[model samples]
Target chain A: MDLFYLAISSTFVNNILLAQYLGHCPFLGVSKRIGTALGMAAAIIFVTILSAIFTWSTFTYVLRPYGLEFLQTLTFILIIASLVQLVEIILKKKSKALYNALGVYLALITTNCAVMGVALLITRKELGFIEMLVFAIASSVGYALALLLFAGHRERLQISAIPKSMQGTAIALVTAGIMSLAFIGFRGMAA
Target chain B: MSKTQHIGATLKAGLWQRIPPFRLVLGLCPSLAITTSAENGLGMGLALAFVVTLSNGIISSLRNVIPGKVRIASYIVIIATLVSIVEIVMKAFFFPLSEQLGIYIPLIVVNCIVLGRAEGFASKNPPLISMADGISIGVGYTLSLTLIGSIRELLGSGSWFGLRVFGESFEPLAFLILAPGAFITIGILLGLQNLFSRWRGEKFIQS
Candidate 1:
């Protein structure tokens, strides 16, 4: 039940994009089309979970035992970079369709910060291995949820009449504001 | 638009022509997340300035030595190292502000502005020029963040740097410091900028 609350709170109330602002690059970059949104979300979900797992163990076993906690930033970044490369190579060899769908986004994930944010947040909260996994999954799910909803609105927004000046980032930000307002409503529901 | 552009133009471009967080639309994450108060925004901006200038200088010097395919990785390694240094320094010297900023400080490793400078300017230029690019862009980022921070601080808390600008009975919106408030604040500022540019008959709002 505690794990369930953690999942719900992170997914809804503490959304990575709308609430925490961890993954704004991906949130705004590939969110124009629904297809691209799904692709980006899928890639983030996959990599965020894996990077969390790897960074956690590395910090716990390697860094902590050796008193290298100061190396957290450098070590976690290197871990995330290698993990992204590994995921890219494996996806290409095993699943052509998935690889094609992910495309440039896979490479971009290495710098997405959501991956690193998950790892860092995990360390900050000092969650156990299982709790870390739960947070990662929930964070990514929240990213997907917000992306899909924004993509849907953006699809309609593409056709709708917006002012000339507010065409791209300006309007997207306003939409995000409204979406964030909605997400705030979920605060009392779970946590 | 010459092959060998003047150094002044590059610096000018980052300052006003293509200022970030507003014009280039890069680094919005920290711009929004940290700008709740002027102090936090200024702190974040200076940290970025240190990281960006140092990494750009290092990357520019090593551009030829780094292989083409691994350049991105190399750039990130350099950036992460600088960020780690800043993180440690802040922890030691500026513990209060460091605690205020939290993970966002370390997350600068992946900040678009830093990497954007690397791929866009630093990789091709000499170290001297790239260092200028970093400082120019860093100053632009600092000013923009400070502007946003002061606005949010004054309105959200009815104070500037906690001085309480407004009278005691004044009701602060309070929303201006929240997550939704951040988006609204930046969005309105972007629109207003574009609107002013259009009034002046200039092409603006690149993306």
Candidate 2:
């Protein structure tokens, strides 16, 4: 019951993108086409989970034992940056089709705060290993869901007649605003 | 161009021509997340400015020494170090604001503006000019965040920087400070910016 609630809450009510505001860069940047949005979502999910696992262990085994909690920001970023590179190189050699799909976004993930944000959030919430895994998957799914929905809107928006000044990002932001308002309705569900 | 003239152009560019959040559209996360109040916005902006300015200077000075193949890795290390310093300082001194800002303080490690300026401007320029560019962009970013924060606070809570701007009878919109309000505020602000620039015949920023 607890895990179910955690999943549902993170996926909807306390959405990492909508409510918590962790990864607005990609939410706005790559949500233009559903195809690219799908790709970015897959990449984020993959990298975020892997990085979370690594960062969690590093913090538990290294940072905590040594009382170097303050060094977490520096350490986690370095880990994520290098981890993305490693994954990219490994994917290129082993899985050609997968590489083609997620290749571009993998590089961009190094800077995407969602991965780092999840890692930090796990530590801050002091979730156990099992709970941490569940939270990571749930949060990435939330991010993916939001991106796909926004992309669908953006695709139709391409055909609509918006004001010249409010055409691109401005209009997209307004749409996101409305979507966020709708998401707020989920607050009651989680509670 | 002469050295001083070049520096002036860089400063001008950072301040208005290519400001981070507004013109460049970089660093959207922090701009959107912490700008619920003027104080938080200014605090976040200043924290970022300090990191970016110092990182730019350090990266500029070591540009030649860092290998091209691994310059990004090197830059991340430099930036991460500076951000760690900021995180520690904020915890030590500005505890309340630090708590309010929360994970964002550490998440600065991944903020594109810091790394963007490092890769784009600092690596190519001399240390002094890079520092000036950092300062200009910092001020520009600070001003933008403060502006957005003020708008949100004044309308949402009928206050600005924690002081009541509107009287007790004033019913705050309450929406302007929430998540949706942030998106709409930035969206409308972006539209207005484009409208003004179009009137002046300036190029439209795609982001």
Candidate 3:
């Protein structure tokens, strides 16, 4: 039940994209086309979960045992950067199809705060391995769900007549705002 | 132009030409996440200013030493180290604000604005101009966040920086402080920024 609550809570009630506001750049940047949005979503889920696991283990086994908590930010970022590079190289060598789909976004993932945010969040919450995995998966799923939904809106928005000043990100953001408002309706479910 | 004048021009450009969160559309996370209240916005902005400025200076100073192939990684390491310093300092000195900011303080390492400035301006420029660029951009971001925060605070709670800005008869718009409000507020602000640039007869700067 606790794990269930964690999943629902992260997925809906406390959505990383809508509520917590992590990864807004891609949320706004790549949500233009449904195809790219889907690709970005898949890449985000894959990398977010992987980086979360790596950072969690590093913190638990390495940072915590020592008095190097101050180095947490530095270490986690390096881990994530190198990990993203490593993933990209291995994916390119092993699976061309998968790499081609996720390759472009892999570079962008290094700077995506959502990956880094989840890593830090897991450490801060100190969830066990299982709980941490659940939370990471749930949060990234939440991110993907938001991205897809917003992409659908943006696709239609492409045809809609928008104000001259509100043509691009401005309109997309307002759309995201309304979506966020709708997500707030789920606040009581997990709680 | 003279050297000092050229540096001044760079600083000025950072303020208006490449102003962040609006012009650059960079650093959206903290700009949207923590700007619920004026004080929080101000605190976050100042913290970001400190990080971006220091990182820009450091990156500029070492631009030649970092190889092009590994520059991005080197920049991240330098930025992450600086962010750690900011996190520790905030934790030690401003406990409540740091607590409020939570993971964002650490997440500053990934903030595109910091890295963006490092790559775009700092790597090509000298340390003095880069630092100035950092200060101007940081100040611009600070102002934008504060404006967003002030509007939200005033509307949501009838207060500005914890001081009541509206009379007792004024009913607050509670939605402005909620998750949706952050997005809507920034969305509208970005629109206004577009309109302002248009009025100035300048092309809109796409992020």
* Residue B178, model 1, lDDT: 89
Location of the lowest summed lDDT over 10 successive residues in candidate 1 chain B: B1-10
Weakest 10 consecutive residues of candidate 1 chain A by summed lDDT: A21-30
Cα displacement (angstroms), candidate 3, residue B89, comes to: 1.0
Worst 10 residues of 2 chain B by lDDT: B198-207
lDDT of 3 at B131: 96
The TM-scores, one per candidate, come to: 0.97, 0.98, 0.98
Error of 3 at B201 (Å): 1.6
Interface RMSD of each: 1.0, 1.1, 1.2
lDDT of 3: 0.92
lDDT of 1 at A30: 88
lDDT of 3 by residue, A74-180 (tens): 99999999998999999999999999987588899999999999999998888999999999999999999999999999999999888889989899889999999
- How many angstroms is residue B87 displaced in model 2 relative to the true structure, after the best TM-score fit? 0.6
What is the TM-score of candidate 3?
A: 0.98
Shift of residue A174 alpha carbon in model 1, Å: 0.7
